[model samples]
Target: MTHQTTPTMLDTDVLIVGAGPVGMALALDLRYRGIRFSILDASDGTVVHPKVGTVGPRSMELFRRWGVAGRIRDAGWPGDHPLDIAWVTAVGGHEIHRLPFGTTDTRPPLPYTPEPEQVCPQHWLSPLLAREVGVHPEGPLRRECRVDGFRQDPDGVTAWATDLRTRERMTVRARYLVACDGASSSLRKAAGIPAPSRHATRVFRNILFRAPQLRRQLGARGALVHFLTQPPALRFPLRSMDGRELYRLTVAASGHAGNRDLDEDALAMVRAAIAFDTPLQIVSENVWYLTHRVARRFRSGRVLLAGDAAHTLSPSGGFGMNTGICDAADLGWKLAADLAGWAGPGLLDSYDTERRPVAERSLEEANVNLMRTMARELPKEILLNSEDGARARAELAKELERGGVRGEFEAPDVHFGFRYASDLVVGDGDSDSDSDGDGDGDWRTDAVPGGRAPHAWLDEGTSTLDLFGQGFRLLSFTDEPAAPPTALAALTTAFADRRVPLGTTRCHDASVAALYGKPHVLVRPDGHVAWRGTQLPADPGRLADTVRGAR
Candidate 1:
């Protein structure tokens, strides 16, 4: 007596769950690779309480590849605002230490990167990415749609969702399913991948407010972040969210609570941090848990995890979102390779092997930063203006100097220092060689296998990094060119036979050659070095096959 109907099927090469910055980043990468993918999110694409404050330099480089770096740089943050990090007894009170990072417009160019970090808070970043991903009816983005459940087989994944607005049920059939959902990913739990916490989970509160005249009042005393040293509750950061009037103050949640205790007054906390009266309007207050977690596995069968779904770390060093963004970049090309059929079985598997370690390393670094703040002993005497207070301030300053607080704000190494070691990367096998030195060497100068290719200025406006992203790029130094006519022919034919995209560029720059530490360097799509040598391999076909994941 019942009528049966076939479910509506929406097919795509990839289905992305969650529309956060990491998911949007994956969408951008897939779009650039000419891959068909759809994004799903339950809520409308609006970032109400922006959690991310800064996009790291490496992430900015990836954004540059996606054609949105320029827009992110110009996202409305004032160019003249101080980027300094100041430690103070209170906002308008005695300053303990100041680490001066010049404003965006006046900062000297970094020798290691073409793009530096940008402060585009999630509120401004979300709409920009959503527009770039296309929010039209016929587009790949599906907002206000919640996926109730999904099932995956060897062939593909079938996910069914109901449009929250229209109540229309639909099914998405995709070759791969990526969970970019937050720290608490339902998909990850469904897949039985446990992201066990590595450290004790702590709760914190973020109060976002608008202080229209505060910037004008403070003037030159203003800084990007004001680390308050007030005893008991106010030993946290009050950061300028948008360089102008917007700001966010972080405070510890009340005793023995984890994001559930709402007893702390937000206004009082804000007032306690700022030592002066100003026109203030509270925007929103949020309670979030800081957990250091890394999933047991980054991939399970056809289901892959990226971003916070795979790991979650403290926001101390601003590495949480940046780490996830890098995950998207690493997973994007591997997914593309698998979908395109050029990927060997291990190529996709290498994603788990490579990215999981980086997440773990970042977790440790972030925990160090978090622990440093938690371990600090802030005395009430630091707040006084008397001689005793000055001594206390000086002693605290000395402790701050010894504690290395600058690492929290200015660790380019944390942003760009990671090296990827996997089966896909071909090591040169010379442990004693300068290029193959142990991991303690400076990352900026090493072109070691499984490391990011060093950046060198190709032109006034272009970097060596600009040559990567789309496919494998082989850079041959003219001083000791890796490929002769025959070698070039063999290499071209080898990669062409497998239909792997490869681009070759011959460079005559001695400086670049020295920076790379090799005459020939093979860089991956994600801008990590796959292999480097003084000359081409004996079997170009084998080299191609190895890097392409055939072996």
Candidate 2:
């Protein structure tokens, strides 16, 4: 497990470890910003079994910004396939409850966002992002490269890595290092960051199989997820993973009778969970521990953590990968700013300040979803095929309605509602600024400072979000030309004096103004409102410095 050599030196602007979706996302953002860096992944960039299934709406928005949303949407998951969630005794067993979310092609357009959620598995997503980051021998991405250790000094970090194929030792020096490594992050551990568990750890097994005829057999009754309700046998989700032949059956592996180890008794247990006589081909099986952990520190010195390295949560709400992608988007711009010689010292510090609390809230929300499934009351009579079984099933379906089952399926608030409360955010304490709730207004659609900039379609193809992510953009609501107001000339002057990148977009649309609720708004590169007001601030340079992390 050890390989040592007189490591040759390689210099770069950033060094990223573990090329999962998170790491590759950071690389993509960095590439978009034209930042020079090297990404190291231990595996050969092949996704054997994708654990993550659905890309959240917020992540889809980020992927849109990264210019990969089209590829993902066309990544072969059918657009007309049913996107419903069904609860049943087995694959072809007694029905209990169902939540019907219309298929992608049939879903209505929403005013909130242009990009909706897509069913892109990690296997499809990872290689796509890797290809975007480049897989050539001389390119930025290095496969089969493992990080052995690293040392951080005053200037940057020097990471020691081994090319697994050749056992060639190399040392990479970078101005900053981002750890997008997975839950058991070697970089996170090496940096001495504490990732304490938030709840009791639970064990589970995922049985990945191929039932080529199951879709044809079900016909119009097919669903995205089938929550198995067979009491004491299986109570986990049996999901249609690929919209085709592939499926994943999540089974509890602790005290249940279905708790057979994958290597020893997987086939028997998988067979017991299926009610149909269709031919089944077991592709793979793996055991995973579900642990909810959030690191106390997202940044330590020049080293920063993103994705599962920064936090880990239950895979219930499909929040794990999306959360990590957001982490990369948040960190990508900050890293670019610092390296481009425009970011202040405090700008890097705000990454943890902004992202950590969002991680905490997301963890709690996902845990609540997990508890809902765990606390469901399953009775034996519900599984019977008699008339009593019909009554019991109907009753349980009504109970599910009362129990708030839709919260698990439709949660846009969890994905897009978190507001950042940090030193970098500039609040409007003016008469229009409302602070009615937990003070900072954690979740709302008001275009409040530190919240996500509200989405609105300006033209046939463009969104209000399409205006952000290049640099600091000043959204001038007036129909006037793209010129700084006489009152705001000081802000423009201050930015120019410091060589900061800023732009002014003059929007005349009344609907956009209404959604923004401010005459002028300063948006960060990550598409969150940095500051908002009807007029320029009294101390524009001070506001500029604060937002860029100096104040």
Candidate 3:
């Protein structure tokens, strides 16, 4: 797409291209920071296939922080729909392995967080975000506005975007430009950043259709996702979306008619998974390449990348969008700090340093999940069974047991246990200390140095996440008189004087204290702990400087 230069000039603090989930998330973060930004997308506001379904728990925590967790939770998914993931020979046939997670209604109360993940597919999610971000003809979120090219100077970035409707070109100048575009990010390619693939690419097809009565048809057999383990072609999920009215069937998109058309064979593969006679309307079919890749670099001068623009991974673990949400959170604060004039020169650089490794880890994990599924050996006997199917069923069950199918669904470690090793993290002397708090620890270290602050229940129906509003926070255990040592008093006062929003709280509860590890924990506006010490520093001014990116 070439740029058509025009006279109209638009200026904002930040300009975001591609209104995907990650882009919308960046806009939301910028809005919370009180920064002016404009978000644009090439397509009109409608999500047809809904590639992403389940939001991870950590992403849900961030959603809680952003004040949209409740709305997202209530986004029309049937409250009673079973969240269990079942692997079977067919949708209603020969069940192999099942991870019986309760429905949204019956889930046991979690100790770490008040908000668990919600199953709102991307189509439903996108509209909710669009409404919250103000989608209008001329608003910040301008649909059908395609970004063609951009140039960056030391001061700011000048982008050339075309209005698809009027065929008019407009220039947008902003302090920074973020590309939340997908894996085939033209913006990243335009900026000369290469996303080298780590694994061989494979093609997949996502078939979205409306099966309003399929839920009732399946009756007691209804599940959030049904992994079809049938033969050579059908072995992916037929997932329910929008309260069972809509469904998406994923299948391998190779060894058949090319991408130009969807062959009847593929449709038949889906039909075999549906055991009941139900009304079905084929909505949309999407053919996409699944890749395991990480960008050579995440930032280019005044331009930065987020979401699939920065990295692309297989969708096995469902970490693609959640990782991007984290990227948005990490970059949003640094941008706001830089614009507000308190961030250190090193602050912006940390974005790439901190997020790139996380993406790499996610890439590897997703690839592993993909391999586990792809490498499953389906014996000929299992595929072609006759009258006495007992032997075939026994063989299939044994394969499922050894395959560790449940690993795909229960991945709390991938979502919550990742830790960041950056210059910002003040490491304890031991190298093992970094991985100290893995799993459900009372006090697990935040993965990103300035990442999402750990979640802890502070009171009845309240979370420690609720404590962080739009500014920095300081948690000091009053029970420990020696905690925020007298030396750090000056630094605390300096933060107060700088007009940096800071919330100070003193907790005496043994559980909360044990979780925090240190007596004094200084959290950033975005809720990641910036500086934590068993005891306060001797020089409060230096502590303030360190927290303000002045190390």
**TM match of model 1 to true structure:** 0.96
Candidate 2's error at 46, in angstroms? 1.7
Give the runs in model 1 whose Cα sits over 4 Å from its true position.
1-7, 255-261, 432-438, 480-482
Q: Order of candidates by TM-score, top first?
A: 1, 2, 3
Model 1 lDDT tens row, 346-371: 89888888889889988998999989
**Best-fitting candidate, measured by lDDT?**
1
What stretches of model 3 exceed 4 Å from their correct place?
1-6, 255-262, 383-388, 435-452, 480-488, 496-501
Tens-digit per-residue lDDT, 318-431, candidate 2: 888888999988899999999988898899999999899888888988898888888889888898989999998998899889988788888777788777788888778843
Score each candidate by Cα lDDT. 0.88, 0.85, 0.78
Model 1 whole-model lDDT (C-alpha atoms) = 0.88
- Candidate 3 is scored at a TM of 0.93
- Candidate 3 lDDT over 1-551, as tens digits, reads 99656556789999999998899999989988899999979999788678889888878877877778889988899889988887777776666667788899998977556677789889889999888888855458989999999999999999998889888888999999999889999999999999998999888878888878877877777788888877656788888887668888888766434544346554565677776566777888887888788999999999999999999999998999999998898899889988988776777887898789889988888888888888877665554456445576677677776777676776767776665555555654434445423334323533223335667777876778888757777777657564535544665677766645566788787777677666777777666667676666667666566555667
RMSD of each: 2.1, 2.9, 3.3
- Candidate 2 backbone overlaps, count: 0
